[model samples]
Target: MSALLELRNVSRSFGGIHAIRNVSLTLQPGQIVGLIGPNGAGKSTLVNIITGVHPATSGTIVHKGERIDRLKPFQISARGIARTFQVVQPFPSMTVIQNVMAGAMFAANIRSMDEARSVAMEHLTFTGLAAMADRPAEQLTLANRKRLELAKSLAMNPHILMLDEVNAGLNTSEVEQALDLIRAIAARGISIVIIEHLLKVVTGLCSRIIVLHHGELIADDPAADVIKDPRVIEAYLGSKFAQRQMVRHG
Candidate 1:
């Protein structure tokens, strides 16, 4: 099957420094893939390029077989690609539901406020923010705010949802809850690209994984095998991690 999203030889540079270089990736329909690396690894930069937050310095980004590299952010979003930020940025003045309603408004079919509200409520309920839907976005706890972020993105009716550090600040139970929610989302046939620092989360949630280091693509394989890759260990997961793994298995 054709890839839902494709990045070909994609690179982005700031001044003389390359933040991403010669990176190519593909996301298949209904697949949940992990994009992982340490800080400064250009994961966000690649997401920005895909979402059109910034233009690529050199290469092509295709979504649903159409070229979107030159498109505007909203244009790309309109075409069914949505993303949640690493830093939650809810509309402080809006109620939790209202913040989600704003995202629902992006759907071309959601013409009336009533329709948007209904759509928003479904996403809010799905994300477990239904109980707090009436509260101001700023009043939510870190975990709730993150749920709100997911709800808002879900409101967009995206085909490919890219989540940037969705589990960043959650407690263990909350992380498990988020994992279940993400699995539900993927079960509904939406392709997901998760950018996470938590290797366990990636290992648990993703079937395929992509690893980046020093702004370059270093590995892409099944989650189990990728973690054992020497290049990945050298670049991010150090030797001590492997030693612990060996001890556990042996």
Candidate 2:
């Protein structure tokens, strides 16, 4: 599979402090990648840079053989890259469908308002939000709120979908539901880069896992192997958890 997105030697900084350091990664079509790291590991910073919410200090972002490092967020969206925030963003006053329709407004495929709405409705259904279609966006429970956020991103007709901790704070069953949504998306041939803290969600849903620490990538491999890396264990996965993981492996 060819790379749909590539970040080469990407680096980001805030004032004088470095947030991301010479990071390079490739995402291929239909691949589900897990990015796991401790807080301040530059996971969000990398997402922001890729999605155009934050400009890179220095690097090249290549998408479909074109440079896109400098595009605005909406411009990036127009280029077929859609990302969901770690914190869900829903228009509180709008209905669930309306919230998704807002994202469809940027879609290049749907030509008219009616077309956008139709597509948005389909995406809400895909994410299991059809029953709550008329509910106020803010009225949904936390799990559904995350599902709404995923639906909104899906409505954008993305070639590459970036999710930022979409499973964080969810109960086990809710996380399973969220994982199912992600699997459905991947099955439709969308490349996904998921930044998550839940190891189970990552190991279960992603084909590969990438580990980050101190703003640099330390491991990128199959999900099972990455979890077993000693560096990943010491730096991010604690000793006790690693012990339990080993026991399960054996």
Candidate 3:
């Protein structure tokens, strides 16, 4: 099967500073891929590039055989690419259901308010936020806010979902719940790219892992192999520790 999304030698620079350099990867259908890196490793920048928040300075992004490197963010969303921010930015005054309805109406192109509401309700229920649908978005707890973000993304009817730090602030049990929800999403055949800092979360939830460091792609492999890679180790723990491991092993 063709890839759901492909990035070819993609690079993005802000003036003289490179945020991402020569990174290329693919997201296959129904796969959950983990993107892990140290702070300032360009993980978020890479997501932004894919979502068109920041367009790539070079290289091409193809989704389902169409080049999308030049498309506007809304255009990208209309094509079934959706993403949630690291920071949840819901419309605070809107009801939870209304916030999701916006996504349905705008990105999914639902023309009627009633139709959007119906679609949004399905996603809210799927994300476990149906009980809170009538509440103002600002009234939610952090975990619920995250769920709201997920529901809104689902309302867009996405083919590919890139979740940036979706598990960031949750406690252990809450994270587990989020993982289950994510798995259910993948079961529907949506390709998922998760940007996470938690090694355990990444390893347990994703079949494949991609590592980035200092604006470059360093490792892309299965979870088991990626965790053992010296470059991935150095990216997380510094060169001295990586050297010590190599010496101790050999």
Best by lDDT: 3
Relative to the true structure, how large is the alpha-carbon lDDT of every model? Answer: 0.92, 0.90, 0.94
What's each prediction's TM-score? 0.96, 0.95, 0.95
RMSD (Å) per prediction: 1.3, 1.7, 1.9
Per-residue CA lDDT of model 3 for 1-250, tens digit only, reads: 8988999999999999999999999988999999999999999999999999999999999999999999999999999999999999999999999999999998997999999989999999999899988999999999999999999999999989999999998999999999999999999999899999888998999999999999999999999899779788977757876778678777
Better of 1 and 2 by lDDT: 1
Cα lDDT of model 2 by residue, 35-76, tens digit: 889999989888999999999989999999999999999999
lDDT by residue (tens digit), candidate 1, 114-145 = 99999999999898889998999999999999
Candidate with more favorable, higher lDDT: 1 or 3: 3
Clashing pairs in 2: none
For candidate 3, give the lDDT of residue 181: 97
Candidate 1: deviation at residue 208, Å?
A: 0.5
The candidate, 2 or 3, that scores higher on TM-score is 3
User: After superposition, which runs of candidate 2 have C-alpha atoms over 4 Å from their true positions?
Assistant: 109-111, 242-250
lDDT (Cα, 0-100) at 188 in candidate 2: 97
TM-score between candidate 1 and the true structure: 0.96
